[model samples]
Each structure stands twice: as C-alpha cells, then as structure tokens.
Target: MKLVVRVKLLPTPLQAAALEATLHACNGAATWAAQVAFERDARRPLGLRKHAYAEIRERWGLGAQAAQHAIKKACDAYTTLKANLRGGRYGRPGTKRHTRALSKPVVFRPEAAQPYDDRMLSWQHQTRTVSIWTTAGRLKGVVFTGQAEQLAVLAEYRQGESDLVRQGGEWFLIATCELPENTLNAHPVGFVGVDLGIVNIAVTSDGECHSGRRINRQRENDRALRSKLQKKGTKSAKRRAKKRASKEARRNKDINHKISKRIVAEAERTGRGIALEELTGIRERARLSKPQRTTLHSWPFAQLGSFIAYKAKKAGVPVVHVNPAYTSQECSQCHHTARSNRPSQARFACKVCGFVEHADHNSSHNISRRGWMAWVCGARSTAPALMLVA
Candidate 1:
C-alpha cells in the first residue's frame, strides 16, 4: 500500500543551475564509488572491500558527513547486487541507478518547502497550498513525496512495516483511502484475471477488454524519420531527434494513462479483485528479442496495476495478485493444456472440452479462478479478492 506522489518543480534559472550542480555532485560520487568498487573486485573477485565512507573520504576528498552519505548509497547498491545474485539474476554489472545519479542535496525537513531552500516541496490544493515533509527532492521533472499518505495508512494497518524505495523522475502517485475489511459477499468475491497482449493492451477476466490505440504504424514512421535524420547528422537533425523523443514520450504517457484509468473503472464497476503476474521476471524471458522486450516494458502494465489497486481501494474494492501460470495456454472451462488453445492471438479454443472464448477473456477467467483457490487455501485474505469477483 505504499505510494509515491510526485510533483514538478518550478525553479528560477539560478535555482535550476543549483539543482544541476547537485545532480553533478551525485553523479560524481557514484562514478567515484563505481571506479573504486570495480578496481577492488578486479584485484580480487571476492575481495573484502573498504567501507564506502572511509574510501570516499580517503580517495575522493569528501567531508566525513558527505562520505558517510556516499557510503550509505554504495552499501544500498551492494545489498541490491547481493539480493539479485541470491535470486539468480545475473545480468549487466551494477551502475548508478538513475534516481541515485540525479538526486539533490539534503535540506531541513521543515525548510524543505521554502522556495529559496535548495530542497523542493510537494504541495496539494487543499484549503490552500498544503505542503508535507518528505525525504525526496527534485532531480528532474519528478519529485517523490516521501511523506506519502498511503505510507501512513500502511503503517497504521501493518505496524513497523516499510517499503524501501528510490523514486523521483516523471512519476505520479495515486492512493486508495477508506478501505474496509473483508465484508463484500456471503461467499466472498474472488479473483480478477489480467491478460497483457499486443493487439489489446489488457484483457480482464471480467469480460472487458481494454484496447490499445494502434501506434505501431506511427512509431515505424517515426523510426524511419529518425533514420533519415541520422544519415544527415546535421544540427537540424539533432533538433528533430530531440523533438521526436519529447513528442513520443508524451504520446506514450497519454496512452498509458488512458489504459490505466479504464482498468480502474472496470474494477470499480465490476467489483472484482485484481490479479497480476509477477511481470518483473517475465520481461527477461528469452522468447522476446531486444525490440520485443522494449515493447513489452513500454506497455506499463505495472503502472496500470498500481492505478487499479489504489482506485479500487477508494471505492471499497480491493485487488489481489496471483501466479500467472499458463493463463494463456490453460483452457478456462476444462483446464486443457496445449498451445493449440491459442491458435491465434485473438481467439482461444479448448482442445479438451471444446470450450472457446476470446484469448484475453479466458486468461482473465483463469486468473480469477487461481486467486479464489489461493484465498480458500488461506494463502492470503479474502477481502482483496472479493472486491473483483463481487
């Protein structure tokens, strides 16, 4: 239930310059840390390394306090690397996470909102411009509201539990409030299935398909234009490239927003709990080429899920995630196993039971069923799942 609300910073030219300097410092610290770590690891593959703070102060000429901060960041990266290794995720070598690279200098929590202060503020138009104390500050366009309302609610419901995060950059937060405990149905509402596909961005188990506006044609045209510009390699070409990047980014975000909002609306109207596959791992599957992988990630399924959960909670609805095992292949009616179930992208035909349905609908149905099974087996609570089914 942790959420991060982000807002843009409207800074003066001088302030913007200061922010840029802060980013440079953060990047410098990261580069220095990376170099040190790389050298140490190269010398001894499993060598015990010096403390980040001590090394930063000694080798990078940073103050004790500044050294401590850099060391803490390095330690966080170390923890992430170790966790990834333990989880069998050996990919590209560690580098500065984008958020870490573009972070701003620390400012006093209370003074953080002061316009003159280096730190940025997160404001809401309540009775007036209300500001909250947050640890996060502006790096680029995004600023994470560290003192998030959702975090407060989570702490109240689940004491002492915390979600570690590094956020800030073109992200916004939405939250669900006034959530009720399990009280949806006599038998309890169960699951929601979500199918992510290319033709349609999402297909819900609830008989609703969220269609994506076909932009592939437009993207191809844009790519062709970029290729032409690359051949020219002129100043105008560079300007066109920047313009294209900005335009495409905006268009993609608009698409994501529409898709996510529709899913939330469906969940509220249908009263079904939500189910999402652990998509983080699936993005790395070898079946997809680099471009295909990029397209899959570009769909913003995770962001859509987050939107649904928070919006559902506000309407006294809930969401639950279940394992996405053969949701695409398993026939919803007879549990038949075969690739033939999905002979085409849009259609599903059951080989075992002669049941047929739209490919997305079948996946949604199976997702709902799996969530109910999990609930009955006491794997998780019933309230969240009931919202979707009821």
Candidate 2:
C-alpha cells in the first residue's frame, strides 16, 4: 500500500524565496513545454522531453532532473487530453467545434508544483531536514516538522518521490511511503449493509446511523455567509468568504474520515464484508428541484464510500457494491417489493405483511441480503431475487 504523509517545512527567508523562485521557474517551463507540444501535436513523453529539455535547462536555470520533470508534466497534460478524446469525454483538439477550448496555454499558479525524484532530493533523518535541487541551486538544511508518528513513518518507509506544495502562506513537504499490504486469515462470515442518505450520512445494518444533521447545519451556515459576502461585492469580503468555504470543506472531510473509520472498524471487528449501493448517476435520476439539487450535490456520499472502501482494504475487510434498485421499498422481513412500502423519508411500512422499520435500516438489510446472494452465487445474474411466499 502507498501512503502520503505531509510535513510542515520551515525554510529560512532566503531559502523560502529561492524555493518560491524554483517553483515558478519549473511551472513556467512546464507551461511553455505544454504549449509547444499542443501546437506541434506531439504526445509522446520521450519526444516532448527531447524537444523541451535543453531549452528548459538553459532558460529556466533548472538542473537536469528538474528540466526532465517539467517535460514530463507537459506530456502528462497531453496524455490526459488524448484519453479524454478517446473516451468521448471531449472533442478532438484543434477542431472548430470542440467541446473544450484548447487555444489557451496551460498556466500554473505559484502553488502549482512538481515532484522531486531521489536524484534531485534527499532527506536527513537525524537532522530532520531535506535538501532539494532548485533553479537557484541546491538548498540544504530545510527543516521540516510533523507529528512523531508521521516522522517515524518517514524515517522507516519513505519512498523516492516527494512533492513541494505551497498553500495558505505555508510550505509543506508531502512524502510518499511504502507500507505492507494487510492480509486477513479469516474469510467474511457475513455482510454488513451501509445505506447512504442526506439526512443520515450512513446507516449500517447493525442499527448504527451516523447523523448528517451537524454537517447540514454547518453547510447551510457557510452557504448563507458566502451569499452575504457575494452580495457585498468587495475583494476582501470575497477572499474571506473563500477562506470560510475552505474551512467548511476541511471540517466536512474530517467528519467523513471519522465516520468511515468507525464503519470500517465495525466490519473488521465482526469479520464481515461491507455492502454498499451502486449509486452512479443517482443525482441525475432523482430530477430534484434547484435547492434540492444543490443539497444533493453537496452530499459527500462518494467521498464517504471511497474512504470506507480504502480503510476496509487496509484492514483486510472486503467491500461490495450492490444494485440499488428497489432496496428501499423491498421489505426486509417479507421480501415484498412495493413503492408504497416506504410511505415517508424516515418510515418504512410493508403493505402486505405489515412489517415496519426505519426506511434506511430496512434498505440496509435488503442491501446486505443482496450482497450475500452475490457473494454466494458468484454471479449477479444467477443471484436469487427476493419474493413473497404464500
């Protein structure tokens, strides 16, 4: 498994200025190389590197590895464009009626950064410093600080590449580390269903619901503040609003991390696999009103699902995505499928057998059953469907 650990870097004023200059020069070279490659229709990395390396090295005052890194960045941009074209994500470049504009050159902000390979960067564990090759020359003794746990990981499992990033007037070093993959001795005994919703972020088959009430309240407050700031129409107000938005996002992400940790821990403790709904394109299918659309779009269902899957993998607990159709309406007790079974958002009442439960809880139960059938049958097509038996 690969993990990235970010540490705060404390560079001297001079070293900070040099680092800033190096970032700008490297990104500038990348922008220029991308423009040249786009104009000449060159997509191959080798050809692009060969074309731009010498110019970048001399003009940008970058070391050899730094110059190659710039070329690689440009080539990667073209590679993304080519993949988009092939996948029909966008129209071909240089066409009159293209889906996206390709005329404008790619520009990199000061924060837009590049990676340092082993040849261009070295870390000192004893000194707690890193030395990096830059346009102004090599800068050594750049002190970095992090939690003891992260420093320990860095000392033991640090990989070859690290990215230098500047954000909110702070410089950080993000180091990649290699870790052993988790292996479990026991197979999954059962499946735990997780139902994701706007009201409750997630509801498990074991009757645990992580409420989204606080998240929703916070988002609404932030949205109101943003609207008020936008109406004021001042530069400082706008900047403050943007910062507030960033803070809100960070808070939401932290909440998701916690919720996912709990869900994965439950599955791991019980030796059960996790079952989640395959909810692709659910927003489009819902055909919600404008306000509802905004609310639904802001929901972090996808991020929460990804967190659960990755954490589960690291804990050696399996995760499966099941078809979402009729999961909410299907009765967990009687297996009767009817839209009327879910009379309201929170309540689930079966029409025929009169089994009642929380709507999300019933859905989770149905989802767990579907996951178990998929696991046992080994094929979705052959999986037996829930039916009412007389």
Candidate 3:
C-alpha cells in the first residue's frame, strides 16, 4: 500500500526566496511549453520535449532535470485536459463551456507544486533537514518537521519523486511511501457493517456509534461566518473565508482518519472484515428539501468510505460494498421492506414482525449479513436475509 506523508519545510529567508524563484521559473517554463504544444498540436511527451526542452533550459535558466520536468508537466496537463474533455467535464462538445476550455492553453499558477526526483532532492531524517536544488542554487539544511510515525515511514520507504508545494505561505514536501501490507485474512470470522449517516456519522453492526452532532454544529457556524464574509466582499474577508474553508477541510479529514483507524483496528483485532454500503448515485436517488439537501451534499461520506478502504487494505482486512437500497427501511428481524418500517430517521419498527430497533443499528446488521453472504456464501442477492446483530 502506498501512503503520502506531508512534512513541513522551514527554510531560511534566502532559501525561501530561492524556492519561490524556482517555483515561478518552473511554472513559467511549463506554461510556455504548453503553449508550444498547443500551437504545434504536439501532445506526446517525447515529441513535445524535443520541441520545448532546449528553449526551457535557455529561457528559464533551469537545470537539465528541472527542464525535463517542466516539459513533462506541460505534457501531463494536456493529458488531463484530454481526459476531462472525453469525460465531458467542462460540457458536451460545441457547448460554450467546452469551447472555452479548449480555446486557450492551460496555464499553471506561479506557486504551483513542482516534482523533485532523487537527484534534485535529498532528505536527512536524522537531522530533520532537506537539501534541494533550486533555480538560484542548491539549498542545504532546510529544516523540516512531521509526525513521528510519518518521519519513520519516510526514512524507510520513501522513493521516487516528492512534490515541493507552497500552501497558505507555508512550504511542504509531500513524499510518497510504499508501506507493506499485512498478511491477508482471506477467511474472516465475520463482518463489521458500518452504516453512514448524517446524525451519527457512522454506526457499526457492533452498535458502536460515532456521533456527528459536533461536526455538523461546527460546520453550520463556519457556513454562517463564510456567508457574512462573502457579503462583506472585502479582499481580507475573502482571504479569511478561503483560509477558514481549508481549516474546516483539515479538521474534517483528521476526524475521518481517527474514525477509520479505530474501525480498522477493531476489525483486525476481532478477525473480521468490513462491509460498507455502496452509495454511488445516492445524491441523485434521494429527494429532500433544499436545506436537507445542503446538509446531505456537504457531508463527507465518500471520504469516510475511502479512508476505511485504504486503512483496511493496509491491515489486510477484506472490505465488501453491499447494495444500500432500502437498507434503512428494511427490518433486520423479519426482512420486511416498507417505507413505514422506519417511523423516523432514528427509529425502526417492523410492521410485519413488530420488531423495534434503532434504525441505523438494524440497517448495519442487514449490511453485515449481506456482506457475509457475498463473501462466504457467494450469494450476491440484491436483498439478503437479515437478522439481529451478533
């Protein structure tokens, strides 16, 4: 399993200036290369390199590797644009949006992240410093910091390329580490089904619930503050709003990481696999009021799912995605499906068997059973037998 570890880089004023200059030069070169490719209709990296490599080195005064990287970045931008165009991301062909996207060559920000290979960057884990090649010169003894665990991983498994990123006036080196996966547990004792919801955030078949009340409350406060800032329409206010948005995202990501770590640890300890609800197209399938829709769309259910998946992969725990249709309203006891079975968002009372249970708990149990059927029994029924959680 490959994991990305981000470490903060603290550089002296001179080093910072060099780094800044390097970013601007690299991005400017890349933009120029992109224009060349656009004019000549040269999308292939090697062919485009032949056209722009010499110019990049001379015009930008970049090193050989940096020049190659700038050209490669330009080629990659075109490749991404091609994919987005094929996927109709901007719009269908002939539409104004689609035409506008293709009208000009893609341009990169001056502070855009640049990749550094081993020849261009070196890490000293013991000293917590880095030595990197800059356009001005080679910078040495640039201090850096990261979590203890990430630092250890970087020392051991860090390989290939690391990106030098400037975010919010701070420099960071995002390095990729290839961590070995644990031995696979092909036959699990059982499955831990986790039901994702707005109120609870997550409810496992084991009846463990992670409440989302705090998160939602804070989110509402952030939204209110951002709205006020937007109405103010000042440059400082807009900057504050952007910073607040990034802070909120970081907080939410931390919460998801904590939740996923706990879930994966529990499943591994109990020799169980995880079962998740396949929520693809959930936003389109469900109907809600405007306010409810806002809350629903704003929740990071997909991020939580992905967190669980990667953590489970690292732990060698199998994860299965079961159909989520009617999971909320279906009774775990009688397998009866009806809208009326769910008296409210939090309560489930089966009309057929008169079984009363927490809505999310029952739903999780159904998901757990379905996962077991899919994994152990090879039964991929749309509706599997449900029962009380063990």
Query: Top TM-score: which candidate number?
Result: 3
Q: Best by lDDT, which number? A: 3
lDDT preference between candidates 1 and 2, better one: 2
Worst 10-residue stretch by lDDT in candidate 1? 110-119
C-alpha lDDT values of all predictions: 0.53, 0.80, 0.87
After superposition, candidate 2 runs with Cα above 4 Å error: 91-100, 184-186, 287-290, 379-390
- Clash count, one per candidate: 8, 0, 0
Give the TM-scores of the predictions, in the order they appear.
Answer: 0.57, 0.90, 0.95
Segments in model 1 whose C-alpha atoms lie over 4 Å from true places: 21-188, 222-250, 280-298, 306-318, 323-325, 351-356, 381-390
Scored against the true structure, residue 291 in model 3 reaches a CA lDDT of 71
With candidate 3 superimposed using the best TM-score fit, by how many Å does residue 209's alpha carbon deviate from the native? 1.0
Residues 285-385 of candidate 1: C-alpha lDDT, one tens digit per residue: 52666665656765556655655655555554545677776888899888987888889877899988889888888988888788777667665431222
RMSD of each: 9.4, 6.2, 4.9
Residue 255 lDDT (model 2) = 80
